[model samples]
Target: MKVREKKRPFQVFFHDNAVDSYLVTKRATKKVVASIRAAYYDNSSKELDARYRGELLVYQTVKVRQRQAEHAEKFYSVDDDHCDLQVDHGEATKRWCYYFENISVEELSHPMNGTRLR
Candidate 1:
């Protein structure tokens, strides 16, 4: 018998550049964001981490509250059903950048070429 994995809601944060990409329209982006929020609020089991090179990088967000000594920072893992976001490592900068444009639910459901959608 195979053990079943628990499903849980997860959060996704888009990088500033990813949100500004021309390949992603405001309407589409809004839809995606809404879906994620709904899933999380609904308590659905879904990983929220972005995937690259067979590695899972948890999505993280840092929040700072005014006049508050403690701020909350959270990281999320992507659902197995959702396509992990693609990323590229900058050789010059030694940093990782994620791609968000041209990503469709279909693509997320089924990733091809292990690369960013065109």
Candidate 2:
């Protein structure tokens, strides 16, 4: 004889709309980039006691305005919980012994303003 089992999957919903936001900057010159509409947030939830654990879903929308043109785009992504643990006592000891034998920033010099603006 055999027994039957039930299983459930995760659910998600995504939306697209203009998300109003702003960018604030402070320096010698104070400026506030206002009315920069971008991707907005959507509702998200997960089952607390489901058959599966360590699952995530994310939704985002973005807006682009170029030369009197505007458009909106939506995106979705899902991920799972993963990690690794290891033991390397010998390697750790070797790394700690050479920690202070590195060079300082002042001992090296490089050029700036060499990058071209796209």
Candidate 3:
């Protein structure tokens, strides 16, 4: 008998500004959602980090609420750039939520390939 791992259902929410700005297509939205979901299931997913840190000009932050009555916050800055997606794992609710913001479609679609601009 094989035991199956239960997959958690993640909810992806976009900031009103982000939806109105760069998330103009279903494809783009799906891509972002998939990336976030992958990250949630596996914290060590290198592909997720590579997409944001290398190809895309998007910043991501991960925060896990501490398991304490005080409810302290532990922040993880994935990169040096400004945050585009604020991924939060709630301790009380045991819910995964992705807050999207600071989207730059043009820059993300066509990131510079190590070419210095004068």
Candidate 4:
């Protein structure tokens, strides 16, 4: 026998729209570079989480700027009932660790022309 389950997340939904996201800092870029340099680094879990959050910020911004007020997605405050113990550990790496770690600033900031880190 099997069962289906639904779960809530532990992420904060509130975000500032100001253009000062830290995913592309010079420091962050350096970290990304270093991670790539360290071949076979088994940190795909962390990297994937960063990448996922980065994409979310970009896509959310794109939606805010392009969509009308009523249609725009609203950022809501977190509620106690909605909170969960387990959080997203981020995506599982689909390729080698190096492939997952080769993220760059340009790609994070501009998804349309994201840098190919392969």
Candidate 5:
């Protein structure tokens, strides 16, 4: 059988809440923060670190929290799945439940070429 994909069908929000050196390392321009060690709560399965794997939980947005976080980023692929997911199950309304890899500020600045998820 074909192996199941581990990544979520939706995109994720990257909030840097002074949680660790994540802000500092993520801010280093022209460099790659290779290992983004994070704990994604409210989720289960091979979805994450084995410590919190396979929990398979999801929730809705009751509210939004704004912070004056000096270093924060909404890590998203411009070539994203905004138009693919069910309208009622909007990815924009979720929180703290996914991962982003091999991203950089420079890449975010330019427009991507191909259509997404084709």
Candidate 6:
């Protein structure tokens, strides 16, 4: 017998925050400063290290995050019978339930392309 299974989906949350080394004034104190590091890598592994200035390299990092989110969902239908025809009573209903619960266009395309929903 052929076996089929369902898959799970996922999402990624990228945090984009940078520190400015210039100066913060409160109407009373004013100071000038320079950037200590040209660039640095964050925990996300998305940021470049010592290769970029402020915000100039953020677009590249955002693209990485977008790609990651595009392939996050996972799930699949069981078989042809379970997905297409209604053969019997119990099997038909059971398969229908499974089909709705797991089967989706995204899941179907993922295996072939290794990603979900473009």
Task: Find the candidate with the highest lDDT and give its number.
Answer: 4
TM-score to native of every candidate shown: 0.20, 0.15, 0.18, 0.17, 0.12, 0.23
Q: Which 10 successive residues of model 5 have the least lDDT summed? A: 1-10
Give the per-residue lDDT digits (tens) of candidate 5, residues 34-110.
22222223233245435433332212111222232322333332223444433333453342133143332236666
Task: Report the backbone clash tally of model 5.
Answer: 6
Q: Higher-lDDT candidate among 4 and 5? A: 4
Q: What is the lDDT of candidate 1?
A: 0.36
Clashing pairs in 4: none
Superposed Cα deviation of residue 44, candidate 4 (Å)? 22
Model 3 segments more than 4 A misplaced: 1-24, 44-118
Model 2 misplaced stretches (Cα beyond 4 Å): 1-86, 103-118
Candidate 6's error at 8, in angstroms?
Answer: 33
Error of 6 at 32 (Å): 33
lDDT value for model 6 = 0.40
Regarding TM-score, does 4 or 5 come out ahead? 4
Model 5 segments beyond 4 Å from truth? 1-29, 34-45, 48-53, 59-118
Task: Give the alpha carbon lDDT tens digit for every residue of 7-117 in model 2.
Answer: 100111112222221111111112111211111211123332333431322111122234224322322222212322213556444544444355432444666666887
Best of the two (2, 4) by TM-score: 4
- For lDDT, candidate 1 versus 3, the one ahead is 3
Candidate number that wins on TM-score, 3 or 6: 6
